[model samples]
Target: TDKPAHARTSNLNEELGQVDTILSDKTGTLTCNSMEFIKCSVGGTAYGRGITEVERALARRKESTLPQKLGADYARLSGEKTFVKGFNFKDERIMDGNWVNEPRANVIQKFLQLLAICHTALPEIDEETGNISYEAESPDEAAFVIAAREFGFEFYERTQTSISLREFDPTSAKKVERSYQLLDVLEFNSTRKRMSVIVRDAKGKLLLLCKGADRLVNLNIMSAHAYNSDLFSLLPRHFISCPFSLEMKSAAIKAFKTSVAQQITDAKALLTSSSETPETLALIIDGKSLTYALEDDVKDLFLELAIGCASVICCRSSPKQKAQVTQMVKVKTGSTTLAVGDGANDVGMIQEADIGIGISGVEGMQAVMSSDIAIAQFRYLERLLLVHGHWCYRRISSMICYFFYKNIVFGFTLFFFEMYASFSGQAVYNDWFLSLYNVFFTSLPVIALGVFDQDVSSRYCLKFSLLYQEGVQNVLFSWVRIFGWVFNGLLSSVIIFFFCVGAMDHQAFRNSGEVVGLEILGATMYTCVVWVVNCQMALSISYFTYIQHLFIWGSIVLWYLFLMAYGAINPTISTTAFQVFIEACAPAPSFWMLTLLALGTSLLPYFVFASIQMRFFPMYHQMIQWIKADGQSNDPEYCQVVRQRSLRHTTVGYTARFEASKHFEEFSEIKSH
Candidate 1:
């Protein structure tokens, strides 16, 4: 708790306040979290279709009809990478492994099957609970493998270490590679933007097969197709003499058999959930024994695929990308960046952030275990920030408004009654009414109103110290407007009731009157009730433009019901006849009229609120623009003055911490300026 999530690394702390640039990962962080393996390139040929990082490959059979024919290598690449492999038709480039095409899975559907009967990643059964659970290395990889099983592909048992399909790599002996040794499988990271596999292929050649963002790839299929379109134009025509390039563009494709596994080897599952933790796969590939390397044409084709690609869509992304990007955002913004992810891959980023909130519902315990704050829902973000944390500030501010007005109005009434009662032998309601009214009806309603206040825009303004300005005046005005609408029609009943009670002295004799002080008392109690309810209603309504949310309506009814029950059974009901008369007043429609009057009075605040929305609410986006356009409109000077005071207060608690650190002098210097 002493250090921020991302501050575990010392270098990041030094770069604070200097974040003038921003860099982010395209997947999961900026974009929704999804990764698939689609598209592939063999020799120089590219294949597969679709935008997601996850895809299915069921079309490239050795016995299919297309631009070219499928050979053993192309079929093997398809089975492993989950992309359709092989060539079609009389076209030499397509069959000769001289060209690649990203064919849509639906391009040929009969062959597409997700056979689930026999598979490496099978559902595990529990005896006691009859529960089902299975394990997969990566969430995305698991999805494709499951999808293949679901469609119709049965798990063929022909594996000593690995598995492949028939008509592709027949004879398990021929299907296996000698030089390429499978190294450790590392998960993708949001920060790194890459996932690599180490392999030692034929002739003892070691190479790192990296598949991530297509932009990082070396070849594209579109470029080559466009390059040889005329060659493809002739039917039964084939271009068998295209060269492969080492430099490539857009590594959007992975080549293997058209099958998948839960995990490549028998290892304890580490990064199963979708997280931001830095996941890396370690593989060893030997290049010395390699016979076929991508030529220039193949490289150009990959580059074309990388450029102009809308979404990284479907590439096996690495775990490091997730963690790295979160750090990048913090560094670039020069501020704390909170990243909430629910995957094992999200761990590094979670540890690397100033604050890391993890969602723990489904992704699993690893993600939740690494998170600082775990929430049950995504919508709770607004609730956490707006309704709970900042509600305290809003409640205090609104209370200050209510307090100001109540004291002023009550003080005037008390002073007036003191003089009149001394002179005329009577006053309005006693001090008990003044104190009891707010405590009972006003307090709960107002507090209840506050309990429900939350908004998208309100939180932003409140965060920046823009809620109020210049202390007393700001406090004074918030209530002026609040009570102005609150008391416009209210003053009439108060004046009449004050006079009638003083003249006739209704409190002196109880049975002489029933509706004696009814107008004033009812208006006073319910006006305060409805106005605060309106404030609650208004606060609720202001956000969604509809005041009838279940919470708003329920809070209103719940508090009123509680008060009604209290009035029915309270000891005060039997204390005095005057009290009993007031309490015994039927649930009449009269005060409700007064409530309408109070609601009507609130119309005056509409324009003021509109001005706040148009002026105060949007002050951040165009604070300077509003000033240049008309600071007089929202009073930019007061805004700036309020801004300075509030900012200093927020940082005050951290002062000692800053003081103990070497950064204090620099912070103080900036503050002084």
Candidate 2:
């Protein structure tokens, strides 16, 4: 949890803000990445009395619906919070060597023995403590070894040709040390979807111990060697198809390539086929079926069916299949997609996504290395995307638009001045003013905007996550917004130029009674430009801090200080700017009056436009801030109310896609059971 989030790429901030669909791996990205053997079915009997998190959730949903029944359920679940890592089995039928009294004790022994003698986990023994720790390629394998040990089949040592275990013999009621001759290991790979280990027991009987995904782990294949062969035949298939399949003996399966293609044609024919309302149907595909479904001819159909369904499950899928699904979703919808993972198997999918987030967890560093962003925990994504991401998008957009506005304001005034002088090339500002305008006067304010400006607080950004839709909609940095800024700059330039020229035309200075020359005119105009642009910056900032205040106000003060200091120097060095501010401009009342007049006039249009937009047609974030100010943000139904009123909710969009696809494994774990 101490692992800090790292942004690997510069431009990914804006992309993170706009992610619409997230395709994530299950093992480590959404999980704790530490595996525990919670439940297992063997010999036609399910062991482990602990209820899964999914069952607790379903129970909570029922309690919430029927409050009168809540107390009874709450009392039943009270004070049952004991948790252990790697081993969570709690059935009294098997715990503390109680499996000896069971009807099929011999079968359980073989299962436990298989767990202890499995492939490819090295044992590290602490000589001082006499405790053994395992280092396996995966958490699942390690969990199996640990669970076996907890059940009194301790796998204490392993070598190239033998696996030694300390076991409790139920018949003798004593602990026995046993060694099995390891023959060969058929390692697990993506293609096989299972791993097997061959070992010769003390009686010289060859045994093949296997484990894998449900689709490939058929107990019937090993029933001939099982002590309780009749019990194995009576076991439940556990191949669940749908909600109502408990009464059905066999599910009517659909071939992936053919059914998907046909369904796409059928879906196109119906008027409401793509409607987003709950349809209660789920699409499930396996690795072998996905192979045919992923061909160019069937890919589009597969995507269409997958998207149209209420949910999708990809079971026994290979690494390539994960990447293919992510790529298909990204390409077909044309929406921004994010992939998250925490293992080497997920690297391809992570890299294929538009935004890749890797979790630094028990899985390893392969995903973290290839990711666009690295986070410590999955929950941190809430802050990453909602708060930091929104801030980044808004800051970049505002900085870019401000650059356009200031450049136009400064350059356009000079363009008008050149036109007013009949193309004589008489500059509107002094050489030093021109040289230092951007570098000194206007630089700090823009830097503050780019680095620290935020439209809303981080807490508020997270509180109202719907505010993120604005960035996804490209509300801040669009062509229309860019053109609007250009227009504002053009208007400011016009007001600053003409107002200065018209007010000072043939006007006399009160102190000296001398007509203002080109130098005096240029100096006054430069003062107006600085005031107008900096005032605009002050108005643009939504949340102001001391840094912004210093930059904005200090820049104006810096301008005046540089002018007086440079003017006080010798006339030869100061040249045209010599005493321009001190003797001519600063001493005259007209300069002050005209400067204030031009500044106010230049900023007047912007003020009106902003007021009108805020008052009449507010954006998503503006409305959210307004609600927060009105004290509605604390209400439980606040997000729902906001969603109902949002313009983005008019059509079913990427938000739904994200909910459906993102963490589907976690969802399936909750609902599929």
Candidate 3:
């Protein structure tokens, strides 16, 4: 199979098939990090009805409708808007229009003002066109500044002590100038979801402006309550239950019910209210709350709120917290975890995960260096995990099983031959032939199988992501299956040895003189071992392509050639011995008859087992378990049946969950339907 263009590492490819949980960073990885201020919240109302360039393009193609649905404000911002490259502000409601006549114009003005004053973006004006751009540490900060510029509050200059903005004043119906002394900037970080700036206006009024994800604000409120240990202790137990529990206890429990209901009502009121707090307020939270939420006592409550709330965002989370969260999910669920990001901050979580994916994006190469796999974009992760991941897991597992089987069959044949010789410890075949058997004859076929064999097509793998759960659940490779292969190898060895010995010991070889008889017996037994080992290609379920077939059959041809060469080169025996060996190894009627008998005796048991499995047990996995007696206890048949039923039920449940995964839907167009 061809590797995807985005993938960087093949070393951990198989890990993709086993991922049960994915922890992803929001910026750069999920959002492209090329921020465009497409929308904003003002006076408890979201304004600015536009989406980003990528979103618009995706929407236009109908490849993804999610971005379009997300831009629900599109209708309001659709008319007569000024166009900006890379920023899709095509709505007239919030672009280039005089703010004097707009509804809630005061709130809109304050919102624009907030965007302009935010930290870290510095303006750069083109000498020829007079168009302004921003230079900032974070793209998101630049986006906010750009949005403010397009909305008529242009942040044009900043110095060590002050900031200046050109604004459209509604009262005067004219552009006005404003300057503020820079008081302080509270920068954004993982733990602090929001950033705040304190500025002294021309009038010397000290004002603090803040913005961030809503979840951050909600967590802050919880943290404030948690800070007061007395108040938190008074609250009912049901609200802050176990970390894993999502269910809320009965409302009949008055203390818990009242507290939760009141908090919900207060949150709703704050979100719905039109008035700005002190000036114009956007409902938001800060990182202090997140820090508090991470503590043992309050972590469960935080998780409850975080999971239950649909639009909550954890702002300003520290990289340590990110890794901790991933580790927590892995420990709680006992599932494989995958973490993806593109920045240095993301390295911790990426390393903590079972499989880490890093985007080689604008953030830097730190994350990519730490990750198991690297990709150009987050979207490519779909094909990487679904198609390539499945192929690697299946191929590698089958290769290992077959490797063990081949070695056991060859090794145990020697063991049986030793027993036949009454433990004299003499070699059955030449040392050179025995050494070359695995390296030259058997190696290429299994290598080809591991690299090229596919039980299901890439299309099918993508369509049924539920199949990936097999790797995570360890359905194919287990102790039982390994032991089962060993048992089969032993059985085949017994059949091959007995059949070959029986034929060689008959009157034909015995009637010859002692020396010639021993030589013929050795040659006949060696042929039986070679033929039995080669017959494994027939029983294997791996897909055999042109290369695989060439290698498998080519090995048999090479073995025959080696035998002819060995007869001519050996100095220990005379010409007559060589002639006798040739006669025994010839493709004569009796030689072929003995070969067929050996093959049939060695393979018949497996053929019958395979037929029964195919006919009665259509499920390949169940057939494997039945062969191995997996999951059975030292109990009655009824108990074993009950255990098997339970196992089946669990598998069905995991399959259903995997089929319904949102990540699968996001990547697989076929599964989406």
User: lDDT for each of the candidates?
Assistant: 0.36, 0.73, 0.61
The better candidate by TM-score, 1 or 3, is 3
Regions more than 4 Å wrong, model 2: 62-84, 219-284, 306-313, 510-512, 635-643, 650-673
Assess every candidate by TM-score.
0.38, 0.84, 0.72
Q: Cα lDDT of model 2 overall? A: 0.73
Query: Per-residue CA lDDT of candidate 2, range 42-110, in tens?
Result: 687877655444344334433543343444544443334355467666566787898999888988888
TM-score of 2: 0.84
Q: How do all the candidates rank in terms of TM-score, highest first?
A: 2, 3, 1
Of candidate 3, the 10-residue stretch with the lowest lDDT total is 246-255
Q: How accurate is candidate 3 locally (lDDT)?
A: 0.61
Better of 1 and 2 by lDDT: 2
**Candidate structures ordered by lDDT, highest first:** 2, 3, 1
Candidate 1 error regions (>4 Å): 1-35, 43-45, 49-135, 139-338, 345-439, 447-673
